[model samples]
Target: MHPQPESGTGTTAGLPATADGRTSSAPPSGPAPAGAPDDGRMTWYVYLAIVISTFGGLIFGYDTGVAGGAAGFVADDYGLSSFMEGVVVSTSLFGGMVGAMAGGPLGDRYGRRPVLLLSGLLFTAGALISAFAPGLAVLLAARVVLGAGVGAASVLVPVYIAELAPARIRGALVSGYQLLTTLGIVLAYGVNALFGAGQAWRWSLGLAAVPGLLLAGGVLLVPESPRWLVSRGRLEAARDLLRRVRGRHDVEAELHEIRAVHRQEARAGSGGWRELNASWVRPMVLVGVLVAFFANGCGINLVIYFAPQILQSAGMGSSSSLLATVGLGAVNVVFTVVGMALVDRVGRKPLLLAGAVGMTVTLGALAVVVSVPGLPGANWLSFACLSLYIVMYAVSPGLVAYVVISEIFPLHVRAKATGVATFVIFATNLVIGLTSLPMLDRLGTATTFCLFTAVCVLFVLFCLRMPETKGRTLEELEARFRAAADSRAHARVSRGV
Candidate 1:
């Protein structure tokens, strides 16, 4: 008889699950099929490890908040114009692109744990240096260093969690990254409200090191990814770790499935960066890449990074603006929990489509309200529009993009392809961040917002075309896409086109 794996939650304790916590359709008398998680109760150790690793995301959220919270103070001390303030705020984003471009190769070559550790160190160094920066140039350079670390962790964390999680609960577990990140943003905003009086913004900036330190220490306590170990030929170690993570002594079936997929990928000569353009691979990679790109285009990060500034521009006091930002950050945290519950339960595309429509409407409201001067309660109305926008964003593109990209690609090329996707996300974010203030200054708030509203419309169209990834194992997803590609090619040849 197969063990009835407990989800460690009272609600799911009686369900019978395969090795990795996926509910089996029947109580089979024999062994599971090759790709199943096998026979194991999903353990809290897996949960603990994933949580610790996801602190990398918290570090990212902290940086976004602390910088935005303190940008005005930073600008006042330096006597910076809007362009220079944007330059200071966006330097880390530019650094993120550079770090993101390198993150894939590093995670693929060095194991995920080590790369994560290095990212923590970079965050630590950058935070400390920025706290003591003597000039704009010094602070800008330190932000670049800090951005690189967060960039790498952004690529590494999602794939790391996806590989370790049971397929049944992978959606919720992976969403933990976004949860922690939002939590971090809230914490930073709180810190800003506390310490943002004078030059005290330095305190908010310096404290980012705390989460960075936690990220490194947490990685130290967890084992490396079993899938990556298999790729590196550490089969014995991979097998042992897999058994422990699955909570069963036997993982031969799962291990065999992983090996077989690698062998298939090898025989097909499909793992190289150049071959990402090949017919079988390109479709899925395009899906992942476009999903990543539009996720940022949804404009949640824009608010996270610039809410205080956006609010202050609308005739609000500095303290009132930071407090309003805290409220928005809370909305970001709450709805992300909603996303965690709904992602696997409903589906990826549906949540995203729903979000895009809501965002377009809210953004349109923002453009209309911000453009009209002396409108009654315009400050409060702007706050309401942003709050609603965060709700839409946090539940969909804000959370799901990372989950889809991490699991959609075949393992053989996952690192490189995910890297490319990660690079696009960071690059898109950089453009949004670097240009936000200048756009708000020159084009006016209403027009600037309308541009993002336009992007959400584009996001809606993309969601209609993107594939759903709910309930499918990584290996299953790869095979499904490859078969679809083959079918399309056959149809084209049949018509002699």
Candidate 2:
């Protein structure tokens, strides 16, 4: 049996059984780090797990980039009109919205790991159905399946990584998911080029299954989130797992921090859906919701979903337009890597503000270039401006929004709240995917660009007041919201309002 602590806190007394239903009779060595690196940091287990989990992102990115390139081909093969083509493209995002809503409660009920496994199954099945789909309706259904998987992965992966990482390194590790997403986009662009327009849409889409299979299998090898364990009242297992994850036996402090926070939350009865809208939480909660909404509103998806069509309208040929997007995909990947490196050091708000300024300027310039009407070099100039916009975006909101949503919520409500935020992300994303092409056709590309620029201006204003969340533990960050809630309660009492 474990020795009793002299302190009366009872931090380790009468702990519950682990999820596996085993209680430790004696203190034992922690779970072995899966791929213990020579660096002795045991966090290779973390790095390994993050890479494996983010494998879901590869398929998510592939769908994001491939759908735009493949849409025209799918339209041609099935004789779909412009409106129908938008429907085909957007069906998956609609599925993703459904998955985003479901992921939170399912994660809270089952566990994050099971949610991931289910997402992978959805990804694989969706890709296979879309690849050999013989008709229009079948293809739309397949896209929806794939979208549900992407939606679930998007919501849970950040929470998974954030909960696993140390405060000092948490931002960078969470940014790793975005890094994989960019790489997946680049891979999709390359696959689109190799398959040839209208020739191999099946192959381009079918390839997503490989990553899905990898994600499903890979999750079996990783540990469950320790916070999840502790929340389940499995403190004994949580304590041992923390030791392995952090590469040290002296994990009592961190374990206590997690346990203490949950104790307070339990006493306050804050775990249910109602707490999500409590006045104290409304401010930070809105922060996440608005960030998710605007991150998509800046019109990044227009490029991801319709870059070739936009470039083709600007005067490029089909083959050339497809090739150009490969370049755009490459730029997205490079800058996302840079953004990941910087998030921990330069801070989240600064990057969001700086990126907002750059996005505004570049988007406005692109509008002017496209509207010049046969101006010399308009297509290349549009490409130049669009490339700059991607650079601004990749380093700022592209990655920051997900990181912030994952890090800034009470532990009890974290996954559920993130699910709500990511739902907005997919919803805004769906709006762009479904309407952007129609908007471009009717509103004129220049006018559409201006609308996005206006959104960017609003984004800049939001950033001016958004809180910074770098270098703080999840427990520490949640306290800020509680402190705000407490201050308001005090004010109400003073005035007797």
Candidate 3:
């Protein structure tokens, strides 16, 4: 009973029903009609949906980066020490781990939309609580809540985007999640620099509620994942929804493909942690978790969670330091877009190798520059190396790690394994975010960067053992992993201790 439009884009005028009880305005005939063109063109509505959904990534960036500028102010206001500084910074991540574990089940059991709505609610509540908190305890508690929301958002957003998009554009649309992530960071840096002098830390923390509200409101207009609908046996509804998001022919074709995969998964019966414990599952999980671990562990968060502080330690004032942090956000955004363009052109593994080598070199140079001063413009060296590190990160692990997490596992154990992997990622982020200040104070920049450089070298060796995933479908990737697992299992049985 919705109102008709004067512009002629109405549901009755050929818009097809979708899985989530909504409809797309595209023809019901689906994407192709047989031997038609398969150029993988997308409608404007697809782009619009991506924009709204990736707001989840925006919140992630804002929450993580805002603290760098506000941490000193909050610490001074609440009389906190370095340990407390780390705790406050990392509290949200702890909540994120909790949320991630919860999100996977919720997303699978219910749908992406409901879990996303819950995440929005958590974000709103956390922002309000943190803004009004009177003590370190309250602030930390509030951050935990916020982190929970962030974690849920992180998992759901990309899953949602990937599910809805066509394969040809899937990487690009998912890459939008990373792009929006950079936008959030840039926005946070600007806001922090603008209000660094005032009681603006309150504003910084509280303003996060704005995006949460927007996401809640925006999601109302999105269609459910057509694949999730098929999994639930809502074929008619799925087909109708597909008609709107995709063309008539594309809808029918995609429905067949999704149904085939779902049927295969159902027959295989492998969607839980127990299934993951089977012989073929262990190594992939190990690789996924370690990739996530080292990606976060090797100084990425140390730089991100403590950028402003690092600049201050290198001798800039708090205000100037906050301003300088914006540069990091800029570099991240620029290089991420570049990296996204290069993903298909250059492939994933090569990018990681390049990023690792670049990270090691830049980090080593940074350590040397910090230690050996008085050689004319040595201070510029610190900022330059930091910028290079940011660029290296944007192009490699920072970009690929999440994509790998999403693609690596088989469908049966995808949610649980990813949840566990994401938990490890959050846990590592918490450790780095919390202990970084004490580490910085005790270790100094020279030693810290040197340690990080060594870590990067280890990452390069680890990545060498990882397989390439360029241009691989989810089903193809799963098949290869299953074969590898079965082979390993056969070996284990033969050894029989």
lDDT (Cα atoms) of all candidates against the true structure: 0.83, 0.84, 0.77
Candidate 3 stretches with Cα past 4 Å from truth are 1-39, 373-375, 486-497
Per-residue lDDT for 352-441 in model 1, tens only? Answer: 899989999999999999999889888889999999999999998888888898899888788788888988888888877778888888
Residue 398 of model 1 has an lDDT of: 82
Cα lDDT for residue 212, candidate 2: 87
Question: What's model 2's TM-score?
Answer: 0.92
TM-score of 3: 0.88
Q: Which candidate do you rate higher for lDDT, 1 or 3? A: 1
lDDT of 2: 0.84
Q: Could you give candidate 2's per-residue lDDT for residues 112-172 as a string of tens digits?
A: 8999999999999999999999888888899999999999988889999888887877787
Q: How many steric clashes does model 1 contain?
A: 3
By descending TM-score, how would the candidates be arranged? 2, 1, 3
List residue ranges in candidate 2 displaced over 4 A: 1-42
What overall lDDT, based on C-alpha atoms, would model 1 receive against the true structure? 0.83
Q: What TM-score goes with each of the models? A: 0.91, 0.92, 0.88
lDDT of 3 by residue, 1-497 (tens): 11111232233223455454454322345343343222355766667777888888888888888877777789888888988877778889999999888888787778778888888889888988999988778888998998898888787777777677665556667778788888888888898888887857989999889887877777887888776676665666777777777755455555655555665666666465576676566777887898788788879888887887777666667776777789889999999998888776677778888898899999899888878756556656678889999999998887777777777776556667777787888988988887788878999888988888999999999888888766666666777887886777788889993
Clashing residue pairs found in predicted model 2: none
